[model samples]
Target: MTSTGSTIEPPTTRAMVGASVDQPDAGIARRRWMSVLKHAGLIALSVVMVYPLIWLVVSSFKPNEKIFSDLSIFTGDLTFENYLHGWTSQQLPFSVFLVNSSILVLGAIVGNLISCSLAAYAFARLRFWGRNAFFAIMLGTIMLPFHVVLVPQFVIFRELGWLETFLPLIVPKFLAADAFFIFLMVQFIRGLPKEIFEAARIDGAGQFRIYSQITLPLMVPALATTAIFTFIWTWGDFFGPLIYLRTRENFPVSIALKGFVDAQSSSDYGAMFAMSVVSLIPLFLAFLIGQRYLIKGFATTGIK
Candidate 1:
C-alpha cells in the first residue's frame, strides 16, 4: 500500500474445481436422458405399426364367431381349425396356388436377370447409332403408368391366343418389359471401371465373352436385387392373373385367395386370414435371404 499499487484478485481454485467437476456430469446426464427418450419413442412407434399384423395373426387362430366379438389379441380358447380348413376349403388344394405362384415368380426372376441385364449392358457399354435416343425412350417408358397400356396389352394377348394362360404373365418379362429394372442395372454397370473393359477388348474378347466372364460375376448385387424384387412383385400380382386367367386351376395364390369370399353366402374370414398369413411366408423368406445383397445393390448403384 505504501508504493504505487494496483488491486489483484485472488485465484478461486475452489470455484474452478467445482465447475470442471460439474460440466462432465451435466453433459453425460443430458446424453443419457436423450438416448432413453429416443429409444422409448422408437419402441412406441414400432408397437403401433406392428399392432395390425399381430391382430391378423391372432384372429387367424380364433373361430369366426369370436373374431369380431372379442377384439382382444389374447383368449383362453384357440384353435388350428382355420388353417386346416383353409388348406382344403377351395376347389383345389392351397398347394396348387402356391405352386403356380412359385413357377411364375421363378420364370420372372430368370427372365429379368437375363433380358434386363443384357439390355442394360448394351445401353451402358456398347456404342451404336442413336444410342442416346434409345436410352431416353427406355427411361420415358418408366414414367408411363401400367394402366395406360393395360387394355392394349389385353387385346394383343387375346389376339395371340395367350389369354387364360401363364404365357401372358411370364413372356413379357423375357422381352425386357420391365424398364425400371433395366435402368437400375444400367446405372450399376456404368459405375464399373472402364479400364477393365478396355483391357478385355485388347485381349480380343468379344462382347459376349466380356459380359459372361467379367460383367456378370461383378453384377451379383444387382442380379440378386432384381431376383428378390421380381419374386415379390410377381408372387403378389393379382390383377394380371385375374385378367388373363379364367380357370381356377391356373390361378395364382393372389387370385385364388378371393375364393374364400362368397357374395351369396357368408365369407370364410377365418380361413382367408389363415391363407393370407401363409401367402406372406415366401415374401418374408425372400427378403431375409437377400437383404444383404439388396443393401449392397442400392449402395453401389446410388439408389436410395
Candidate 2:
C-alpha cells in the first residue's frame, strides 16, 4: 500500500509541474502577442504622422500641375526653382524676415531666462511674507484667458508708442509677464535638494554666488527647455508681429509665408509648401539641439 501511495504521489507531482510550465508558457505567449500589437500600433501612428510632412516635401518639388496629381512622394521630379522664386518674389526680403525673427526669438529667450529664473529663485528659496498668497495669485493668472487682457495690453502698448517696433513684443518678457514660465522654473528649483544650497551657504557663498555657480549649472535642463519654448513661440508669433509691426520689412517667416497666398491671384501651392518647409527648419534644429535637456528637465520638475 505504501509503495502504491508513493507511486501515485510521483505522478501527481509530475502533473503539478506540467501545469506550472504550461501556465507560464501561456502567459509568455499572450505577452509576446501584446508587445507585437503595441509595436505595430506605434509604427502605424508614426507613418500617419510623417505622411503630411512627406507630402509637403514632395509637393515642394513638383510643378503646379503635377503637385496634386503625383501620388508618390519619393518619385517626384524635384526642382529648386520654387525656393528661389519664394526667396526673391517679395519686396521685403526673406533674409530680412529671417533676421527679424532671429532677433525676436533671441531677445525673448534671454529675457525669459533671466527674469523667470530670478523670480523662481526668490519664490523657491526665500521665505518672505505673503509668499504663498502671491504664488497662488500668480498661478491664478494662468487660468485667465489671454483675450480678456489682450485689448488692455494692446492699448497700453499703443499709449506707450510701442506699436510698429519689437519693443512691444520683447520688453514685457523682461518684466516676467510670462507667469507660466516663472511658475515652471519655480517648481523646478523647488524640486532640487535643499541640502546643496545649505552646504553652499555653510561654505560662505552669497545668494548670487550660489545662484550663479550652483543653482544655474544644475538648472541647465530647465533653462534649455524654457529657451526652446520661447524660441518657438517668438518665431511663430504671427498675431503679435501682425499687430505691432506696420512695416513689411519687419515680418517674420510666419507672416511672410502669407504673402505666397495673395487675395487676387491664384496662389502657388508649390511655393507655399516650399516656404512652409523652410519655416520649419529653425524649429526642427532647435528641438534637435535641446531635446535631451528638455526630456531631463521634465523628468525632475513638477508643480509645487
Candidate 3:
C-alpha cells in the first residue's frame, strides 16, 4: 500500500533467518551421519583384514593338533615350543635364513634406491635423445608381465652362471629391472620444483651434484617408500630363492619356511605358522618405520 497504490510484499526476514540457521544444522547432521557410516565401514573392513593376521599369530602359539579344531583366537592352548622347534628343526638354523634374508633385503634397498632414482631423474629432469620415446617404451614394459620373461631371465641367469647364487636374486635389481619403483620415483621427482635444479645449474653444479644435493634430499619420502616396498618384496620372494638357490644353507627365510612343509609327509603346522609369523617381523618393522614417509609420498603423488 504505497502512495501509488501498488500492492507490495515485504521480505520474509524471519523465514530467511530460520532457513539460514536450519540449513547448516541439517547439513551438519547429514555430514555427521555420513561420517559415522564411513568410520563404521572402515572399522569393519579393518577387522576383516586384520583377522587373518590375528589368526596366524594365534595359530603360531597353538599346537598342530588343536589349530583347526580351536576356532577361537583366544585358545587357552598356547605354547612357545613352536618357536623352539621351528628355530631348531631345519637343517640350517633359522638365524642363518634371517641373516641371508636381511642381506638380500638390504642389497635390494640399496640397489632400487640407486638404480630407480637415477632412472627416474634421467626421465623426469635430464634431456636426452628420444626421451619421450624411451619413457614410453619403459612404461610399455610394465604391460609385459613378469611371467612372460621369466623363462628367458632364467635361461640368461643360468648361462651367466648366476643360477645357484644370490646374484640372480640381487643383481638385476641394480640394473633397474623394476619399472614400478622407477615410475614411482618419476612421479615424486616431477612434483619437485625445477627452480632448485635451475639455481644449482646457475651455480655451475653438474647433473650429478644437482641429483645428489637437491633431488636426493627432497626425494627421501619417495626413497623410503621404495625401501619399504623393496624390503617387503625381497623378504617374501619365495619363488626367486626357490628357483636359484640349490643348497638349503644359502636359503632365505621364504625358502627356509618350506622346510617345515612336506606335502607327502606329516607337516609341522605349528612350526610353519611360528616361522611365518617370525618372517613377518621384518616387514612389520619396515612398514612401521617408513609409514610416515610412505604416507608423505602417496599424499604428494596423490596415489596409494
Among all candidates shown, the one with the greatest TM-score: 1
Is candidate 1 or 3 superior in lDDT? 1
Q: How should the candidates be ordered by lDDT, best one leading?
A: 1, 3, 2
Worst lDDT 10-window in candidate 3 = 1-10
For candidate 2, the per-residue lDDT at 22 reads 33
Judging by TM-score, tell me the better candidate of 2 and 3: 2
- Sort all candidates by TM-score, best to worst: 1, 2, 3
Model 3 residue 177 lDDT?
82
| Whole-model lDDT per candidate | 0.86, 0.81, 0.85
Using all chains and alpha carbons, the TM-scores for the candidates as numbered come to: 0.87, 0.87, 0.85
Write one digit per residue (lDDT tens) for candidate 3, span 27-46.
55766898999999999999
Q: Which stretches of candidate 2 lie over 4 Å from their true place?
A: 1-20, 262-264, 296-304
Error of 1 at 90 (Å): 2.1
Give the better candidate number (1 or 3) by TM-score: 1
Question: Per-residue lDDT tens digits of candidate 1, residues 251-297?
Answer: 89998887765531757778889998899889889879988977776
